[model samples]
Target chain A: MTDATDFAGSSREKWTGFSANQYFICLKGILVREWLRYLSQKERFVSSLVRPLLWLFIFAAGFRQVLGVSIIPPYETYVLYEVYITPGLCGMILLFSGMQSSLSMVYDREMGNMRILLVSPFPRWYLLVSKLLAGVGVSLLQVYAFLAIAWFWDVRAPVAGYFLILPALFFAGLMLGALGMLLSSLVKQLENFAGIMNFVIFPMYFASSALYPLWRVQESSPLLYKICLLNPFTYAVELIRFAFYARIEWTSLVVVLAVTLALLGAAILAYNPARGLTVRKQDMGGSQ
Target chain B: MKLQSRSPETPRTDERAAVAALELASISYNYGQRKALDDVSFSIEPARFTVLLGLNGAGKTTLFSLVSHLFSPRTGRIRVFGQDIDRNSGQALRRLGIVFQARTLDLDLTVRQNLLYHAALHGIGTRVARQRIDELLHAIDLTDRIEEKVRGLSGGQVRRVEIIRALLHRPSLLLLDEATVGLDIKSRATILKDIRALVERDGISVLWATHLIDEVGQADQVLVLDKGKLVADGPVATILSSTGTETINQAFSKLTGITDMNVRGGRP
Candidate 1:
């Protein structure tokens, strides 16, 4: 004879015993949990789709007529500016998308669920990486959706080029995600987030190869051109630009990797429980 | 919930105190130059309800935070069933449950959904998790309102939900830190009765941190705290008898040396 209930109970307990690796597991859980949440918000998908579409339709439409084309590698000759800038705009979208996800971390803190999450028995670093990966996954999906729309237009790249962008996008997303995490770990106040946007966002974009080629900037001003060449976003946009030709830029990939690893490591260090953006207030009494 | 002579060490597995449910030995925590908790030590025994009694700024929450392994302690040890919380926190926390002073339930989730999500975090199987959710709904008197959104619930209802959520994994060492907020008299009594029943059925140990003495007299033991230090700890009867006070209020005031009557009247 079998005690079905008791046996089932033991097995259930055995399963939860695996929660010792809680940080990674909980991070995955939050990913799926928030993914479902993101799905339910019809407005979020609409906005993600619309943001890139507007830039592709309006900004590219106007800029295609003005900017002179340059022979970016893998391009046999000078190509239209629209095709050149599509990946750059996508990079911009992802950069902000990563930061948007970081803002949610601040929101979660105000909600108190963050306390439940951060107090879990898992390693905090793994937990943070899991969250970063989830945000990057969402950003990549939006990028693909934007690319699918681009194919409907005359801006299509080679069929094989689509497959090559995966790793490029991953590292790119990782780099931006690291930046977002660093900002979130440092910026504890919601009111000061706008300060990050004004200071970090536009400067990074205007200084990168997203809007124009590095050579074009050098032709105009040497100092601005040097800043563009040094910017990591330049490497990210360059990765996407090269991948469009169904070829990977090995140098750009290395640069993005180095930057992503260093920034993510820095974010982890800043997020140490002993200091940094840890909760300053403890609830001695119940909810106010 | 049926178990006998539970080992405190392997509480989640054997339903015994496997070791002591929780142990804090010579524990001290510092923030910059200030000490938040100074040499605080206590052990929670199986089936014994212990109340951590203290006032505001008394370092009660700091002690709870250290025990939960939210951050590493500057000095000393925190253990569950003799397992160091830092090194073996996964196994140690598995044996215990905590309801912090803040409301932790996700407002977007229903009562059942909230429990289900927490169970998933703990890696409880879906089938067993569902059954436990239903059991908790009944236990918390929320069976009729299981699907209602948590944001819609009153303060008292949310408190009950937190307790039910904590108990879903059937933790051997349950911690309630000022969990009485927003709860009315009847609701409080109901919650107290349910937890007492759980303690009797499984001999589960509990450490409830609270400022009020009335709601906690049922505790088997009481640890009196003043500032960041342990002032007294013993059986409830013994503590009250030695303090020479009729109630927890008079006793608390007599010990703390601050005889402000207004603070005492707020106790129900």
Candidate 2:
């Protein structure tokens, strides 16, 4: 009706000033969409669990006889290889899920939905943070789902550790998600993400202490041991591993927190409108 | 509709009284070494339907991007309601609504969901957002289809939904870039008429960018862009008379130096 336009115009004056409510609404919208997407694609839930499950079941099962565990701090006695690698596998889920979120960012940009997001009235940093938070939320769900499946596979943490792991997993998920956001900002096209998976994800996954203990890697080579110590993923795995035993690794917690803040800062800078990868290409016609 | 004739160089008193809904001064953009938009300047008055006419690669979309703040201009300044986009982009953007040339709807989301999400982005409350969505869907005659996924809608229906999304925040200025590019003739007419009615009734300023000559009506202001340069800007009648052509189509061809009619088949 013609009167509808008048109603909109009159109502516009009432809502002129900015409010914190707007930020929450925007965040809620983003999170709900992501949740809906996750729900709709049932295969993503299965596949996210599958990668970690394979490592916990088949890979760890093969390495069980080859590798012998020592009395790690959280464990009172020597544990099986599968148990030793559970936290790392959880880190794996978060890592892959983070990259998957970035992949969707690329896809959204290509599909023009990113434009809608960028044009929103909210500050760019708030938008990016909201997106990162949403990614963490989704990845956390996947981590829990994987953990549940691992329980069924006869790999269990202390009952209290399950609760403790929530915060630890949240931190790790945020850090990984932030890293993924940074990678997405640098990547110019969707096709280039495959290169990132090999160059960034795999390297970050393997070179870290995710698959093997740092002490073991040190026994093989001291230089790699140092690298593993420095890898943020190493701290993430350590944080989760300690939490799984109902203990706190202050060192890992500090490292994971510091790395998350740093990566998030970098991600925000990379997504800045004037200097961002996407905006640059949009201005310069994809030559970059 | 009575068409007011005015010279491009003169700004009427009434026009000067109201702040421009959208303004770009000496805006230029470079894509590598190639200039996508040369030093261009124009301003649209509040509540007027202004047509930005350009052929393919004539810098229409580039200008739209600049106005929308998707790409900051290398050389010039853009303002919405007199707010400089570079200095106060958030405020300027708040007063602006944009419908891009590309399809931006999330196909998996239902029509209501898409609209609600957009409303949330603008900070509208859930109750107000739902009411507005219902009103908009009713206005577009797509009320029954609100529950359907966007992918299930016809191309024209999707475009209508996009228009509603842009209008949800009740922005003072609306910019549509090639909004009717792929629509059938009937759909195009409906969309064009609807936007025109918005201008007439709601007093919402519009910058409708397209390369189609037929879309330009007599009363509308026309800005002709040629090879990244603004070759003409005035009312449709003024543009026609200035180019010494009887029709806007011939005027466009004469100004742009394109003689092939098939090449001008409502594209670009």
Candidate 3:
């Protein structure tokens, strides 16, 4: 025991201090881990792109002849369906990426690594935010990769719009990522995630203005248009769509921002140790 | 039954200095209608190895969760080194380290990466984190395995890495919740020896939670819980003597009023 004290005392002096810099270190570690995981799983990159490209090339090409899209603000002339849906596909990339990150969060919780993150002295909000930021970072990379592919496919945004869209992409990614975080807190098991993709991912994508313009939906059915207007995913897609044209979609921006903040607040509450959705039956011994 | 007196070295006086490394005062937790811990109260001294002995569903994990702030007690207060866990959780948690009952390492990550990430969370700089990691790995005789991914490591090896991850920030109090649950006898013994050595040599207070009676030593302090209630708490010899039993197994059976072999098996 004396030896233990002696060793600790001497050893303690070599590395013993805490500072704000550690926050960045933690954030860096999280981002690096995400990057490493992304790098290792080349299939994820391919899959993420494949979904959007399928929509752009296959669905867009097929719909081009069938659908008549009026010249949207960003487009000076009547555009091909592929050109119109490119930004929507960008939104899709973010949506799936966000959900994928949350899937990992659920996995982390089940596997006990989430406990490691929660136990850190930092505020839970900070940890959750870091996770969101890392997810957003990854999702943004995927978005740009998709965009670069689109560029080669002759669906080019203005050169400046490509750079200008970064902030829009970030905010959209954050909102979707935050929503995913909230869902992860509510979801108790991995088996339930497939249900989320079905109920959340598919509905949000199809019901929103991602595929067809809201007016077109209104012309076909006013009720579906009303639902599309209410869907936050609509705003996310609109934000990206407008960004690609170097145009400001204030309504979309405001809606996405509001949804992001609300979902973020709800997520923090859901993850709260005292009264959050994370309170589990296993944690409390039989209580759900 | 006459309760034995406190050890002479036990600091029970000077209220401020004797606040204990960890303390739970009237702590109670519930899962909706079901009570997980009922008015549990205890305190552990610094530099001592206190074994929290309990059977399955005895609220051991619940208690650990509360202490780690994963779940806050609906009633009562928990303090770490006199810092209130609820009111001052950041400070309290800063002095604490924990290895949960479940496996926590990211299997894809290298040993060094896992530890370094934890170090960064505690706000330890990279340079200092690297130095501490090196020393701890050396201490654990895992210096050569630093670059190896956690998935390649054996269960016992991963547990060792988790322990090292917990200690990287030099937390004053270390908690292990059923850390040896799945390990072989040799691995369990090695871990137990290493942790006990930490207390004896480094003066780091330890709260080792498990149901295994064999893990409790005569010199060690024991806090026994049964069915979410604190049944007995004292030195091992004192608990045995007070119960009028020859061994801890018999004493635990006597205290809990359960004679079933399966209940006393401590297999899980």
Question: lDDT by residue for model 1 over A1-288, one digit each (tens)?
Answer: 012112211212333434343343456566775675566567777787787788778888888878887786768887777788888877987888777877766666656676666665446677678778888888898889889888898887888878888788888999998999888777766677888788888889889988887788999999999998889998998898788777888889999999999999988877665552455442223211
lDDT of 1: 0.73
| Superposed Cα deviation of residue B177, candidate 1 (Å) | 1.9
lDDT of 2 at B52: 91
Off by over 4 Å in 2: A1-17, A280-288, B1-16, B265-268
- DockQ measured for candidate 3: 0.35
Task: Indicate the TM-score of model 2.
Answer: 0.92
- List ranges where model 1 is wrong by over 4 Å: A1-28, A274-277, A282-288, B1-18, B144-146, B264-268
lDDT of 1 by residue, B1-268 (tens): 2222222333243445355767888988765677777898888776778888887667777788777766667788898766688776766776677888878888876777677667656656557778877866775567888888798999888987888777776666788888885578887777677677667765677888887667666888888777778877888677778998777777777777658746632322
User: Looking at candidate 1, what is the lDDT of residue B230?
Assistant: 84
lDDT score at residue B266, model 2, on the 0-100 scale? 34
Kindly state the number of residue pairs that clash in model 3.
Answer: 6
Clashes of each: 11, 0, 6
Model 1 alpha-carbon miss at residue B60, Å: 2.2
Docking class of 1: acceptable
